[model samples]
Target: MTPEDRFPGPEHPDSGPRHQPDLDVLPYGTYYEPEPAGYAEAAYGSETYSGYGGARYLEQHWPATGQAHNVHDQQAAHPGYEPTLPDRPSPVHQGDDPPTIELGPPLAEPVPAYPYPAPGPDEPVGPLYVVGDVHGYLEELRAELRHQGLIDADGHWAAGRSRIWFLGDFTDRGPDGIGVIDLVMQLAAEAAAAGGYCRALMGNHELLFLGAARYGDEPVQSTAGTASFLAAWRLNGGQQHDLDRLEAHHISWLSRLPAIALEDGHLLLHSDTTAYLEYGESIPDVNDAVHDLLADEGVDEWWDCFRRFTKRFAFRGDAGPQAVHELLDAYGGSRVVHGHSPIPYLTGTVHADDGAPPHIPGPYIYADDLAVAMDGGVTMEGRLLVARLPI
Candidate 1:
């Protein structure tokens, strides 16, 4: 099928408001410009897809796959200049307050009971639960949540009055990413309704999926001036089924998701990179910066923002503490809880026995109490993690 035939159009009942394009459909990257300010405002102002009843939205906005100009092309176009480093702003003089961001209005009023499942009368309330990266694998995700008593036998949420934070990467690389996202969206709504809340951070995959859906075959001249979303998606494991489910509304919701959130005293982010410091001084500012980038559809700078945000493994060894320190100093959190880097890699298990695949069963505490690597490599033969937080 042709690209047009493959993508079709929005499938969700709630497509929300639509807009006319200034230019006609062009091959990806034909009209490269900075995204307009109105783009962000329009994209984020819609109803969120999170909540138990919003599975349709999840299915409609799933990730897509394809090949475009390759990253090698990006490098070839750039020659010697590095494209990964972020553009830096002029250094501010000392004594200036590192930028401050006003956290948005309280998400919603807390409910009386937990939305998913109330804890047993005799069971102690779990401190807080943080799940690792669930790259699809809905069955594994369900099993892990059930193992933690976060859900019941019926596959419904059951953790009442307890908070749960998903470290992101809910989709991609495995079957049923859409299902996993749908469940999380629903649990977030249910938890909020129940006085507790279920929250997630944005992973690079989320950004990739959002870009592929919004831009599709539309090419954006990368910093290298030749790369496009089509190329990026293929490198990143974009799936055809995900593209079939893409919708404008889902893109809007994913674009608005926060890049980082602090729970209790733990800092939660999708990747271990300290590049968040480049956006703003605090968590809120960083998130806003990310949202601002997602909203600007035309600007090549938006792609640059995404490219920088996608870098991972920044917190592996010597740089790990420094990276954690930057976030801790800015976000006022004691520990940085993150996904993106799988636990097996973080724990140095990449070269396990020949037949035994790397296994990261649940949330992993790392960095000598400074960081937590949550991606359990569920996309592999490992387990999906759902653990009590504040451990």
Candidate 2:
């Protein structure tokens, strides 16, 4: 029979169209890449047979297809044509018939589900307060919440009928990152139960935290080229305690937090960056687009998205009002309230001491009053501000 009959398919007519080389033809003593010896079996096999010897025995018993058998030495065979490792011996069929073994007990019966009741329309909306970046200053956050009557002296939800929105950066560069997150989570639960709600926006620090948690020491491309998230986290003042306390719930929540929020003709966002214009026209659409990207993208792509979002100082100079006007025109908002750029930085204040109270100059209203900066630089010993809207 011609080689075409044996291999089959389209091949160059010259030299009988070089046949695909079979892996079995490789030398038996070919370089044996050192695996963990029994790593495969431990990963793929059951508890009963998962070690080195068991894996070796399994490979010997169920020889891979096109594997070269050494007539003299059985262990020195070349696994040429085999693309996969050997299978384990099954109890059912030991001889000619391929043995089949059940993997596990049948899945438990499906639990009955309760139908979700639809929410009523326009269910008594409350005044929304969008907070700026906290950066781990728990005491400042507490003071601000108290100032806004959102929380009481005992650090409990004080405003029984209002909503509070945190625009992210709850951790890093200051004390009590964990404490801040814990407080927010507790308040969110309490507020939801009490007919009020607490929501948050996603900031770049959150993306950094997520990357560090997932990639660990793996190198990822940043503005500084190939830098590991772990290194970046350390450089950005990520606490070891905070890293250890991070859970899937935190990551998922951070990832799902909206990039933009709209309230009473006001556009609420974390960063003062114009990169948001690349997403969509409407606030909801931009949020959805960002969420979709964070959900579907890999580490590199997500990091790039975060890097772009982290670009602040957009509403700082002469071009500031122009940028605010662009957002206002697109999203139908009269003003933009953002956080990433701290108020103290806008006012050019330097912190004297760790415990010294922050000096926030009357809310640092800028961009011709089109953009409001609320960060107050609490992380830098500045005041935690809570301003009434339409000022």
Candidate 3:
């Protein structure tokens, strides 16, 4: 299908004002409130998809040394570069006044619930939860996780034996990307000790950050003239503070994140694009291919991977359900859960620069109820979404 054919116009029913519902009492995904109309025409209109035509997808990939010694060698080769992490695990900055993010209000009315059955005595896993794109809004993230009973007032993992998967894009666009990463790393360790595990996926922004850190200003070929990883990252909301605080451990952690995961009958991915099919047919093969690429030193190949994953809206419009089916057929998930295209983008009500806040009810269920969008568009003054799965 043509690029324009993939998105719905304002006249389309999916682009109309959503039926806002009360969130606290409802089990998510029991019903669906379609995102606003005109989102396609408003968001992707006039954008070319051939080679990074839009600002959202305007990022190139990276080339890595593949070994610790090589990274150390690169640091030595480039003087005055010290990669050291902060000793503390808090997302709040030390000494400075805490960054204040005025989060948007949640849904208005009540919806039906779909509670999962309690695990049997032999059941090994606990409750499952998924987090959308954080985009460096550290405080908002903490508040949302706390609201979901995942983390406690102290910000430590309190959901014992419960699994939480962050759908990537942890850094950029807002304040304290590094702080967010540090917090996630800390949670992963703490959760494992508590029997519950906290893990993350690799988003396009991760690739952009890694490219900037590894390649710096090294030029890469782009359809929009010559581009570099650092330049693209900055253009796509890369924060100077994040870059300054980036350490070797952060790099290693980000580098090793998987592109996709299958959890509790949900296929979790960072982006909504069907480009994952290009990597491999099954989950392990796809992840292995991406990991292998990141472990190599091919700049263009890495850029291609990043660019492909950056593609969004593949599972939207009329063909959206079918697109989701393709992934499910190969990956063994009843639903595809992702975070890249923000919920507002699907709603078409709020832009990133809009002064007013956008009302995001909860995880958007679409694609004929076969896919769920977790991003609450935190970067656009929208809510940071943390949801329990099967919703």
In order of appearance, the predictions have TM-scores of 0.67, 0.65, 0.70
Best by lDDT: 3
Candidate 2 clash total? 5
Each prediction's Cα lDDT score?
Answer: 0.55, 0.57, 0.64
Cα lDDT tens digits for candidate 1, 1-391:
1010011112111101221211112111011111233422242222211221111222333233233332222211212221221222232132643332221121233323233344356754434777777766677677657645566667765666668878777665566677777788778777665556677878777876766665655666653446655445544445556656656655665677898888778888887777677789877788888887777546356555566556555554444566677678988889887877655444544334564555333355544458776666655444455555554
Give the number of the best model, judged by TM-score. 3
lDDT of 3: 0.64
**All candidates: CA RMSD (Å):** 17.4, 27.1, 14.7
**Where does candidate 3 stray beyond 4 Å?**
1-123, 351-355
Residue pairs with backbone atoms closer than 3 Å in model 2 (clashes)? 23-80, 24-80, 358-381, 358-382, 358-383
Better of 1 and 3 by lDDT: 3
Q: Give per-residue CA lDDT, model 2, range 205-238, as digits (tens).
A: 8877777677666656654456555555544555
**Model 3: colliding residue pairs:** 10-38, 15-36, 15-37, 16-37, 21-109, 22-109, 22-110, 29-391, 36-347
